[model samples]
Target: MTNSKKFALVTGSSNGIGRAIAENCAARGFNVLLVALPEPKLEEVTNALAAKYPNQEFHCLGVNLMDAGAPQEVFQWCQKNNFVVDILANNAGLGNSGDFLSKKAEFYFGQMQLNMVAMVMLTHHFLPEMQKLDKAYILNVASMASYYDIPFKGIYAASKKFVSSFSHSLRYELKDSNVFVSILCPAAVLTNPEVIKRDANMGFVSKITRQTAEQVAEYALSRMFNRKPVSIPGVFPKFYRTLGRVIPHRMQLRMLANAFIKQSRE
Candidate 1:
């Protein structure tokens, strides 16, 4: 990594929205440090991005963020390599749709570890170094589900709500600092085959609010740089979020529960 070039450390960046964010960062002149699970895909993405943006540096670290102490390990690796991370994108997360009881206890534990705990740990480990810079940014990838209590995606929604709340609080605390914190609460993103199929099966609302991974990444980075506290990528998602605010919480819960229950059965 070049000492003069800024770096964006992006988690879960081997595929999906994470990958798009890494690519977008490179396009915007930031060297990228891509973190994901140990897989050939990670190396492939690293090489591809390096070739595409020859002027920028692209590095990959494959480690499971859900494991204890993993965030510290990542920070140490960056320190060892002298990779100054100007932007921290805590984008790694896990989500599954099913009846809460249908999944094993281990599944929920791992989901929380990755979606909530890992995000917090990574931010904690990185924030001090980020604050030392003239300007830095932390982008937490939450979900539009953070705004509602849905039936089938209860755990995922709750985890994202934690992200939303944590990001807002942290951003407020750092209002006078160089560290700018933002959260991306995208609605339905068409990320992969499974996600595409799942979104196709959902209601009209999901379809209308759906965005491509690239679209979400573009919007998220723009908003993050602009210091926008919360970024919802699509027009329909913004509208839906506004509408949700006016509806009573009990009615919103019932409507979401009914819709998700029917969708799950189908």
Candidate 2:
């Protein structure tokens, strides 16, 4: 209320999909709080957005969204600065690709930390404030993995599944509260190079029907602003999800495994 412009907060917004979402939100007339780790790369993105969206205001938070203190810290920062967030986009996520037993439990926990836990924490902390307002939106960036299990990315798939389910149930829970939740599930997106480095198997996926970060952001935010419950951004992903109903799970898993193997080689 202190600032005349409506507010939105995007997590892990230094680059890739998160950064695109932050820029999209700003273009949509919402001042954005760009959250990322304390790094020069994060600062660089902040400076670029500030310059590009000169008409809109943006705040940068350098706290780890996966940390225990992140949710409270973000809330306090907003309150101190008198920024009222009408929209919250939970976009920060980490990938896990390896044999389940071979990988440490810490890796699985880290997936939950970024994908599931951080999202829940931020939503819990912000929902009360959002409910107070007459109109508000919450967008959770899930993945195509939400509906299926990735063979090597077992934990990553599970984490996204949590995000998809949690957002759906919470959407119903808050139905009468006037705070709508949008769960965005997009297929393989080739953005942050970190993913390619983390799992060399992702290289071949570049040839697949992958979406760009900007495309995902544009479509997702447009539908979210309209209060859509579930959004499948691109044409290919929506088609795949529909066809996946008839595709056997075993075959689906096999195809994904082969794709990973190909990426690794590339």
Candidate 3:
């Protein structure tokens, strides 16, 4: 039964890394359910994937995951459609780039809900079904900021840190189960023109560490299927993660602040 039902549910599948992951899953012959807001991009991606992978089924659900009830709605939709999800990719996230004080509390809190709460809710609802499968996987998309206490991007960093920690603990807890859980931490992915412009402004380190969405997705899924607990997408980001651990805390803070200053100048 499990082998017969190879459906993957990917949140935020309209664009960026989410789109890449969805495309990858379809290429691997998995029926994909693309979830995102009710936007034109959602249908666009669904149609494109359907056209590209004619044999593999592709469906789209346009809903705002930020709504507290969204997780249940997604689960019910799967039930109604007879989709047995074997893979759950929680890729939807939000972040603010500037100083925390620049935005209202609602803005920051909304990001928290989307980045952390919605992810947790989706995982909570989907993990049980995944556990029933003979083989399954859960891939969460975190960020490089997950490793640090960033200044201007404080809330965003904290949210990603929660994701990183939650994924690690969940993986360990489900170690005995058939389902494999992995978290991807990638830095400066070239997802769109705006992101490219932003990364360009972040200086040499950002440029060198940046990866394409396809690149990140390919490497992340490979490592996920291999049952790796964590995946850091680029050589530089991995090295940077390791180096951050060894560096003194205060020094790290100062360095990050300085980097932020340099980025501001750019």
In order of listing, the candidates' clash counts read 0, 2, 0
Model 1 TM-score, all chains together: 0.95
Q: Judged by lDDT against the true structure, how good is candidate 2?
A: 0.82
In model 2, which regions exceed 4 Å deviation? 1-5, 194-208, 261-266
Write the residue-wise lDDT of candidate 1 on 1-266 in tens digits.
Answer: 34545689999999999999999998998999999999999999999999999988999999998898888899999888898889999999987777888889998998999999989998998898888899999999999899998888899999999999999999999999999999999888888675776677775878898898999999999989998999999899999999999999999988888767755665
lDDT of 2 by residue, 165-209 (tens): 999999999888889999989876767675646334455343354
lDDT, each prediction = 0.90, 0.82, 0.87
Clashing pairs in 2: 201-264, 204-263
TM-score of 2: 0.91
TM-score per model over all chains: 0.95, 0.91, 0.95
- Error in Å for residue 111 of model 1: 0.3
For TM-score, the strongest prediction is: 1
Native RMSD of candidate 2 (Å): 2.4
The positional error of residue 230 in candidate 2, measured at the CA in angstroms, is: 1.5
